[model samples]
Target: MRIAVVGTGYVGLVTGTCFAETGNTVTCVDIDQKKVDKLKGGTITIYEPGLDHLFLRNLKESRLHFTTNLAEGIKGAQIIFLALPTPPGEDGSADLSYVLGVSGQLGKILEAYAVIVDKSTVPVGTADKVRDAIGKNAKVEFDVVSNPEFLREGVAVDDFMKPDRVVIGTSSERAKALMQQLYAPFVRQGNPIVYMDERSAELTKYAANAFLAAKITFMNEIARMCERLDADVDMVRRGIGGDERIGKRFLFPGIGYGGSCFPKDVQALFKSAEDVDYDFRILRSVMEVNQEQKTYLVPKIKRYFGDLKGKHIALWGLAFKPNTDDIREAPALYIIEALLKEGARVTAFDPEAMENVKRVVGDKITFADNQYDALNGADALVIATEWSAFRTPDFEAMEGKLNKKVIFDGRNVFEGPQMKALGYYYESIGRRPVKP
Candidate 1:
């Protein structure tokens, strides 16, 4: 199978590389000359684990390639994947200009029948819009299939190759058969390849992300209640998670959800509802609750020092989540902005996000060399992202590094009593306060 993937972003690159790994010839097309050149040179543009190896190997084998010219790249491909960006508009609805604009271009140049798959996350009815956009000038038959990706940033390659389930939304039997055949190798583990209408398929991606966001928001609300009532959110999470209905996955109450999926999807769902003259009340509440959760540690920080002015705070993490460097809508951003406005000085550390942050938020705060260095002369340590390294650190080292033994843990990375025994003032979400 010959596949051409447009956009060459996270999803596009991963999708093209993985498809090439599975014995398909893939040409990834990007409009950015620099990015296409980088891909062509075998240098990875993203930080997805296990993707570089496959990408490099596939490129070496001549099964995978990259180009800036869309017509040249997608020339003879049987399947063309539009894994483009459908970023949120000002109104929170997904802006379909990228998808539609490319669809229009595809309509002009396509000389034969092709299966145009919408691998990007788009709003409902986008498949029809794309189909119509292309159909206007298309001389040959083409099917627009809404096959949304459910890949996580860190483990995108594995997710793409061995998804839990594959959803295809096309009424055309010919398109369905080609898609099924293309994905057959992946679902050998018996994961169902569910077929549905295009609209349902588009909504499924949004619904999944929104549900996960709602789940995280609900847990954060519980954490807030626990803080007021002297209950342990960890224990409460465990107690409820033990139930068959509430299986434990995202039960931990963190500083809200962020990155590429949850926030955008939740807002898109809300916007989609508004488009139809309906108010998605639950989703609206979910968004409000999540915004508070992101900056949930502000009050705790202020209470710790009485006054944030002239305070030196050590921030342990800055990325949205662990195992990935994405910081879009990161809780740490909200926390840092609040701290700065309160006249506090901040020193932050992350395993991989520091350089990226430096580009966008240079000199906002000092960029620490490492976790221990971040604590140097700081009043307290605030745990933002739940990075694995932050779970266990040298307690004595932390005590020695900081000017004072105070910790505000938003991710609840430590045991309350353990921190107290270590002679530090530790504050965490819905847990017993650790007093030094």
Candidate 2:
């Protein structure tokens, strides 16, 4: 199949590259001339694990192409994918200007029958809006399909290459057949290609992300209760996770869930419920709990020092999670802002996210070359993101750099007994503090 993907953002780029890897000719369209130029030069703009190899290979093999002109890109293509952004508005509803605007343009230039797939995480009924917008000026027939992506940031390549299930929302038999054929290679392991109505398909994407967000938020609340009741959350998490129903994934307690999807999708779903005169009370609480969880360690740090004035804190991680450089809605940003407001200076280090953080907060905080370099002259150490390197460290080196052996671990990176034996004052979520 020949496919044209509009909007070369993270989702669009990955979708186009992965499709091209499976023997489809793909041309990606983006309005950003510089980005298109970079991609044309065989440079990938996003940092996703295992994406670069496939991207370079596909580009070299002439299966993947990049262009700034949408008409040129979509010409002779059987499928057009709208992978544009649906960023949240001030009122929390999705801004559909990008998706609908392109739909209008596609109406003018479309020459033949094609399947237009909505590959972004959009609100319910967006496919209807898209179809109506395109039908206004289009003379040729085209089928608009709602096909949302469920790719996690770190493992998007794998998720695309081997999806658990492929959801295709189209009423037209012609459109459905094309989608089924396009995704047949990926679902060869017998994972289903679920066919549903457009509204249900659009809602499915939001529901999946919102449920995951709520699950993580529930565990965070459990961690809070464990702290107040003198119980260990690790043990509680392990106890509940062993049950087949509860499962182990997304059960680990941390600052909160943050990324491109969860925060935006949860808020959008809550607002969508309001549009229909329904107040989703659980989603409301999930939002509140996650906000507090992001800064849950602030009060503990303040109580320990009485005043944080002139305190130099070493922060071990900045990315929201591990293996990706994305810092959108990252809890580290919230923590850094709170610390700076209290007159505490911070030196931070993350293997990949430092450059991104530096762009957002220029000269506000010092960036370190390495994790240990961040500890030099710091009063204490704080772990925000659970990067692999922070799991085990040389205690002697950490002690030598810090002014005192005091640690505030937000991710619960260290064990309770080990910190006690090391003779350091270590505090962690839902665990007994170790005193020097």
Candidate 3:
């Protein structure tokens, strides 16, 4: 298979590299000359685990290539993937300018029949719009297929290589056959390739994300009630997670759900509902609850110390989740802003996301070299992202590094009983506060 993936962002890069790993010759196209040059020079641009080896191996084997020129990149390609950005617009709808603009360009230059795949997450009816855009000037036959990606950031490579289910939307038999053949290797383990109409496929992506967002928000809401009722959320989580119907995933309560997917997808889905005069009340509540949940720990932190003026706080974790350097809508940023507003100084550390955060929060707060270093001279410690490294730390070293043995655990990384035994004051979500 000859694959051309447009837009070398996180999805595009991963898609292009992973396809090339399966013995397919993939040419990735990007408008940015700098990014293309970096990838061409054997430098992997993203921080996906287990991707570097695959990318380098495929590149070394001459199966993967990168180019800034769209026409050149798509030449001799059997499948063209439009992995362009569909960022949420001011009206909360997905801005399809990038996807449509490239589709229009692809129409003019396609020399042969190709299956154009929409790998980017977009609203329903986007495939029809894309087909219309291409049909306006296309001299060659092509099929526009909606093939939304379901790759989680931390384990994107694994998700792509061994997807639970592959959703491909196309009514055309020829396009479906090609797509099926292309993805046959991935679904050999009996994982289905669900074929449906374009609109349903588009909605599937939004629906899955919205449901997960709601699940996380529901747990956070339960955590909120647990805090008032003096119930342990961890026990509740374990109690209910054992049930087969509810399942175990997305039950852990935290500050909130924030990343590239949930926030944007939920807002877009809500906006889509509004366009059809439908009142998605549950989704509306999810949005409201998640927004409040992002700064859920701020009030608790303030309650612990009545006057936060001149208080130095050390924060651990900045990424929305662990194992990736993405900080699109991380709770740590909201916490930092709220703390700064209360006249509290903050020093934070994340294994991979500090540089990205530094770009957004330039010189606003200090970024520590390490987790322990972040505690130096800090009044209290706040755990924002649950990175595996922050799970277990030398409490004696942390206690010695901090000005006070006080901790605010937003991710509930530590237990109340253990903190009490260690003679440290600890606060966590949906759990009894440990006071020493």
Candidate 4:
């Protein structure tokens, strides 16, 4: 299939490159001339694992291309994917100007029948809005389909190459067939291609993210209760997760869920519910719980120090989670903000997220080249993100580097008893502060 992806953001670039990998001729269109130029020269801007290899290979093989011209990009293409940004408004509803603006332009430039796929995570009924925007000017027949992506940042390539299920929203048989054919190679492992109405498909993405957020928030609450009742959350999580019904993903208690998807999607869904005169009760609590969970370690740190003024703290991780540089609404950012507000100077380290944090928090805090580097001249260490490198560190080196041997393990990276044996004051969620 010949496909034109209208936008070269993370989703658009990944969609175009992945399609090109599967023997499709893909041309990605972007309004930014500089971005288009860079992509045209085989330079990928985002840092998704395994994406660069496929992007470079497809560019070399002539299957993937980039352009700034919408008309030229979509020329002779059977499918057009609108993967533009729909950032949240002040009121939390999604700002659909980008998606609708491009849709209106497609109406004017479209010359042939095509399947326009909404590949971005949009609010319910957005497909109809896109269809209406396109239908206003176009004389040709086109089918607007709601196809949301469920790709995780770190494992996007694997998720795309082997999706658990593909949801296609289209009433038109023609569009459905084309979409099915396009996704045929991906779902070869018998993972279903669920066909649903446009509204359902659009809401499915939000619902999935909201549920994941709620699940994580619920576990975080359990962890909080465990702390008060002198119970270990790890043991409680295992006790509950051992049941087949609950199972065990996202059960690990940490500094809350924060990513590009969960916070935005949950808020958008809440705003959407209000727009339609419905109050989503569970989601409201989920949002509240998550917000508190992000900064849950602040009080613990303060209690340990009695006061944080002029305290030099070592922060081990910055990214929300491991393996990606995305710091959007990351729990580490919340921790940093709280620490700075408390007059604590922080030296933070992350393998990938350091540069990203530098951009947001320019000169606000010092950065470390390595994990142990952050510990140097610091009063204690705080584990924010669970990067692989922070799992097993040289305790002697950490003890030697810090001004005093104190630790706040937010992700519960180490056993509490072990910290006591090492003769350090270590505090962790749902676990008593181990002092030896």
Candidate 5:
């Protein structure tokens, strides 16, 4: 198979590299010359786990290539994947300019019959719009298919290599057959390649992300109730997670859900509902609650210290989650902005996300070389992202660096009993505080 993937972002890069890994010839196209140059020079741009090896191997083996020219990139490709961005617009609807603009361009250049796949997460009617865009200038026959990606940030490579189920949206029998052949190697484990209408396939991606966001918000609400009623959320989570009805995943109560997918998808779904004159009440509440939950720790910090004007705080973790250096809508950014507004100085650390945070908030908060370095002369230590290294730390080393033995943990990294035994002031979500 000869394939061309446009817009070499996270999803595009992973899709191209993984497809090439399955012995298909893939040429990835990007508008940015510098990014294309970087990919050509053997540097994998994104920080996905296990992606580097595959990317490098495929590149070295001559199975993968990069180019800035879209026309040249898709010269002989059988399938063209549009993995472009659909960032939320001012009105909270997905801005489809990038996807539509590229689709229009692809129309003028395509020479043969090819399958055009919408690999980006888009709205329900985007496929029809794309088909119209291409049909305007295309002289040859081509099929536009909606095939939204379901890859998670950290484990995208594995997700692509071994998808549990591949949902493909196309009405054309010829297009469906080509897609089935292209994805046959990936679904050898009997994972069904579910075929549906284009609109349903488009809605599936939004629905999945919205539901996960709601689930996380619901647990955060439960965590709030647990705190007020003097109950432990951990116990409640475990008790309910055991039931098959409520899965264990996405049940951990945290500050909130923040990433490229969940926040944008939830908002887009809500906007899509409004466009259809339908009120999505639960999604509306989920958005409201998630915004409040992101800064859920600010009030606690203020109550603990009467004046935050001169407080020095240590914060651990900056990424939205672990194993990836993505900081889009990260909860730590919300906390840092709130703390800075209160005139408090913060020093923060994350194994992989600090550089990204530095780009967004330059010198607003000091960046520490290590987690303990962040605690030097700090009034309290606040854990934000729950990075693997922050899970277990040398408490003695942490104690020696802080001005006071106090900790405010957002990810609930430590238990009340352990903090009590350690003789430190510790506060966590939905758990009893331990006072020194």
Candidate 6:
């Protein structure tokens, strides 16, 4: 199969590279000259786990290519994937300018019959809009298909190589058959390829993300209750998670759900419903709760020390979650802002995300060389993201470095009983606070 993937961002890069790995000739097109040049020079841009190996292998084998010119990239492509960005607008709706703009250009240069796949997460009916955009100037016939991606940042390569299910939305039989043939190698394990109309496929991505966001928010709510009622959230989680009806995934409570997808998709879906005069009350609540949950640890930290005017706090973890360097809506940023406003100086550490956070916050906070280095001279410790390294640490070293044996764990990485035995004042989400 010959394929062209537009907008070589996270999704586009992964999509093109993974397809090339499956023995397809893939050319990725991006408008940025520097990025295209970097990729062409054998430098992988993103820091996804296990992606660089596959990308380098494919690039080395000549199965993958990159180009700045769209026409050159899609010269003989049978399937052109529009993986452009649809960022949120001021009104909370998805801004479709990038996707539509590229579609218009594709209309003019499409030389032969092709299947244009909407690989980006767009609003419902975007396939029709894309088809119209292309139809305006296109001389040849093409089918616009909606095929939203369901890749998690850390494990995107695995998710793409072995998808649980493939949702393809196309009314045309030709486009459907082509998409099925393209995805056949992936879903060989009998994970169904769900075929539906364009609108449903577009909505499916948003629905899955929004539901996961709600589940996380609901657990955060339960954690709050457990804190007040003197009940342990871990025990409560175990009690409820045993039921088959409510599967145990996304049940762990933390500072909140934040990344590239949940916040943007929930807001967009709510706004989508609002456009038709419908009230999406649940989504609205999810938005509000998640916003508050991001900074849920701030109040606890403030109460621990009545006046944080000169306190030095050490923070561990900066990424939204582990195994990726993305920090789109990371709760750690919110916590940093709130602490700074309270006149507390912060030193933070993350294995992979410090450079990205440094770009955003600049000199507002100190970046540490390692987790223990951040703890040096700090009055208390705060765990924001649950990176694997932070799960177990040398408590003696932590006790020796910190000015005081105080910890605020947002991710509940350490057991309360252990912290109690260690004689450190520890507080975590939905669990009893350990008092030394």
- Model 1 Cα lDDT, one tens digit per residue, 213-324: 8888889989889989988899999999999898998899978998988999999999999999999999999999999888888898898779999999999988898888
For candidate 1, give the lDDT of residue 76: 91
TM-scores of all candidate predictions against the true structure = 0.99, 0.99, 0.99, 0.98, 0.99, 0.99
Those runs of model 3 whose alpha carbons end farther than 4 Å from true positions after fitting are none
All-Cα superposition RMSD per candidate:
0.9, 0.9, 0.7, 1.0, 0.8, 0.7
lDDT of 3 at 194: 96
Inter-residue clash pairs, candidate 5: none
Writing each residue's lDDT as its tens digit, candidate 4 over 180-253 gives 89999999889999999999999999999998889888998998999889888999999999999888998988
Better of 3 and 4 by lDDT: 3
Supply candidate 5's per-residue lDDT for 11.
95
Candidate 5 lDDT over 1-436, as tens digits, reads 9999998999999999999999999999998999999999999888989999999999999999999999999999999999999999988999999999999998999999999999999999999999999999999999999998999988898899999899999999999999999999999999989999999999999999999999999999999999999899999999999999997999999899898999999999999999999999999999999999999988888899988998999999999998899999999999999999999999999999999999999988999999989999999988889888998899999889999999989999988888899989988887777897
RMSD of 1: 0.9
lDDT of 3 by residue, 1-436 (tens): 9999999999999999889988999999998999889999899888989999999999999999999899999999999999999999998999999999999999999999999999999999999999999999999999999999999999999999999999999999999999998999899999999999999999999999999999999999999899899899999999999999999999999999998999999999999999999999999999999999889888888998998999999999999999999999999999999999999999999999999999999999999999999999999999999999999899888878999999999999988888999999999998889999
Residue ranges of candidate 1 with Cα displaced over 4 Å: none
Model 6 lDDT tens row, 40-109: 9999999999999999999999999999999999999999999999999999999999999999999999
Which run of 10 residues does model 6 get worst, by summed lDDT? 301-310
Clashing pairs in 1: none
Off by over 4 Å in 2: none
User: What C-alpha lDDT does candidate 1 achieve relative to the native structure?
Assistant: 0.91
Compute the lDDT for candidate 6: 0.95
* Model 6: lDDT of residue 243: 93
Off by over 4 Å in 4: none
**Residues 1-436 of candidate 2: C-alpha lDDT, one tens digit per residue:** 9999999999999999999999999999999999999999999999999999999999999999999999999999999999999999999999999999999999999999999999999999999999999999999999999999999998999999999999988899999999989999999999999999999999999999999999999999998899889999999999999999989999989899888899999999999999999999999999999998888888899999999999999999998889899999999999999999999999999999999999999999999999999999999898999988999999998888999999999899999899989989999888878897
